[model samples]
Target chain A: MYQKSPTQEWTSNVVRYKKFSGSWAWLLHRITGLGLTAYILVHINTLASLQEGPEAFNAKMQVFMQPHWIFAAWILFGLVLYHTLNGIRIVIIDFGKGAKYHKQLLYGAVVIGLIVFLWMGYIMFFGHAEYDFLSMIVTSYN
Target chain B: MSYKYIGSRGSGSMSWFLQRISGIVLVFVMVGHFILMHYNPEMGHSFNRVFERMQNPYYQMLQIAFVVLALYHGLQGVWNIYRDFKFPSWLNMAVLAILIVVGVGFGALGIANILHF
Candidate 1:
């Protein structure tokens, strides 16, 4: 049987490392970050319809107003929520004393992320249909 | 002889620090964005609705900042992830250049959308 040399041991070990909470967290953070980045590019391009005029933009947006697109947006929001919460945890661990309690921070982040994700899901699916009081603060077009 | 892969780049302490700061700002802006876009789909999807909001110069400025920061943070993140692996320096430079182009290109489009209002 061939064996890795001492110099290559560290790299091999990391590549074949066991999965744990921290590993999962790191992987998920990267995954969601990449997905969100890709989505941003697509979002920017999609909104370019505005340059073609209101009818063009409205027609483009009309496609996304469908239930399927709404569902997709909800899932996208889930990724954003997870990424944001974990980002906060990363900041705490790096800038503050959260390393000692990093696991707990991950747990807290997951809990809060879930709550926000579900709440946003509700809003994307149901709350958007009617006039929301809080929405009025930012939304009012003649 | 065993082959060892030493990275060919400097320690990116500045980018590391900025990533955290930009991430923090993104969270706040994203929250407000979610409220405005998701809370009322019409406000998000309708050009007239967004036009009304974009009429405010401050709001337009905020949106431009959002685009720049988001692009920077996201592309910088891709570079960070790439750094984790041992790639040839040319590939690294190429990837970095491409990320810059994507950031600038999409950034212009996002700003255009806002300015079009």
Candidate 2:
């Protein structure tokens, strides 16, 4: 009798399976998908604060505009950017146009993501004095 | 006595198709939303600004549609991931039921908030 061992199965499924570009892309897609879904649920609840009136909602917004929270917001932005770009890649492949150049598409998505991220990051962190203005209004809205 | 359900396996393709459709819709709606919220923070982040926006029937409709599409896309993605785990049939059904309840609950709450204005 011959049988595969549990450790070997784990290695094959978990370790080696993640080595390729496609696998890495798949893994990142799954992570970003899950993260975005979780964010949507929380976002709805936060928006529901409007039922309590503007003060309540503004209070929540104040917390969200804090420096640490702003960093998290940037990370969330990056995740959505990556997911959206990769999603387009997936759609192109599904349309049967880029199956052979899938690897190139993945790399192309990453390069584009980086470029957009830098541009957005600069605006978010520097180009907008209005970011501060908005935070002030949110904090003082009550 | 025993019973079995027929054609339980046919939903996979339907879900796959729906996910892609919802993803395309989300890409447009979400990018619009992000630009509105971040690119124009002064107009988007103020309580008065949001209140004003929600007052418009068209804006409310857009928000409601966004919520519905997002919930469907997100819940479908989560369900697809769970399917890969090969859970037992009974547990799978339980998970699906829970996901449905949560998805519908959030969607209703979101729509109600939009309509509240």
Candidate 3:
């Protein structure tokens, strides 16, 4: 058995965890930003292809609608949810919400990210576009 | 801005600026994108509609501009994240060079795809 003092071990772990948390937040933000940006490039360019004809447009659209792209879509969607929620958390912290409240807000951000990610997952998987706000009223309970 | 209050305008400052600018652009782009893709997807999603839009010289120009800006902004943000890790200076520069090359290469391919189509 490793016989390190518990107090020393605990303190070291706390410092390590703190470093990890900050790095994790920074890393997630960067990754999400990149994914979202790639999506933007593909999106605008693909839309630009509409100039060719419906056949060309459908071919491009099919690429995006494929299974692999759908998976990428979910991942990018989740990243967006996390990045935006965590960004708002950072903004709150920046505005002088300090000490205990800041940590509390960070936890709140994680919860919000999870919720939004689940919603996105459901929508992406469903294939139907009913999840869009305006579409629901017209399609359902009319 | 005072030196103490203002942050270093080195890599960090540049990265910060790029992220903010790109994020702002995305807000407009994302909303427009979703509307075009999902709202009346059947109509707007057609290639002919896309061709019509791109056929407009102004839209074509804007599309090119948008691609360049998006790639620059995103790659810069990624570079900033990579820089956050303390690495050897040479390694940092190499990584940066690679990112630049890849970004530009992708941008070219994307442009070609749009133009040729």
lDDT for residue B57 in candidate 2, whole number 0-100: 91
By TM-score, who's the top model here?
Answer: 2
On a 0 to 1 DockQ scale, where is model 2? 0.71
Q: What TM-score goes with each of the models?
A: 0.87, 0.89, 0.62
Q: What is the C-alpha local distance difference test score of each model?
A: 0.86, 0.83, 0.64
Q: Any residue pairs clashing in model 3, and if so which?
A: A50-B47, A50-B50, A50-B51, A51-B50, A51-B51
Model 2: residues with Cα > 4 Å off, grouped in runs: A1-8, A132-142, B1-8
Q: Pairing residues by index, what is the TM-score of model 2?
A: 0.89
Fnat: each model in turn: 0.90, 0.64, 0.40
What order do you get sorting by lDDT, best first? 1, 2, 3
For candidate 1, please provide the TM-score of chain A on its own.
Answer: 0.80
TM-score of chain B of each: 0.89, 0.88, 0.76
Task: Provide the clash count, candidate 3.
Answer: 5
Candidate 1 residue pairs in backbone clash: none
Candidate 2, RMSD to the unseen true structure? 4.3
What DockQ, between 0 and 1, does each candidate earn?
0.75, 0.71, 0.34
Judged by whole-model lDDT over C-alpha atoms, candidate 3 comes out at: 0.64
lDDT of 3 by residue, B1-106 (tens): 4433222235465566556665566556655654465445454445666666767777667667667777886777677666556666667667777888978877
Interface RMSD for each candidate model? 1.1, 1.0, 4.2
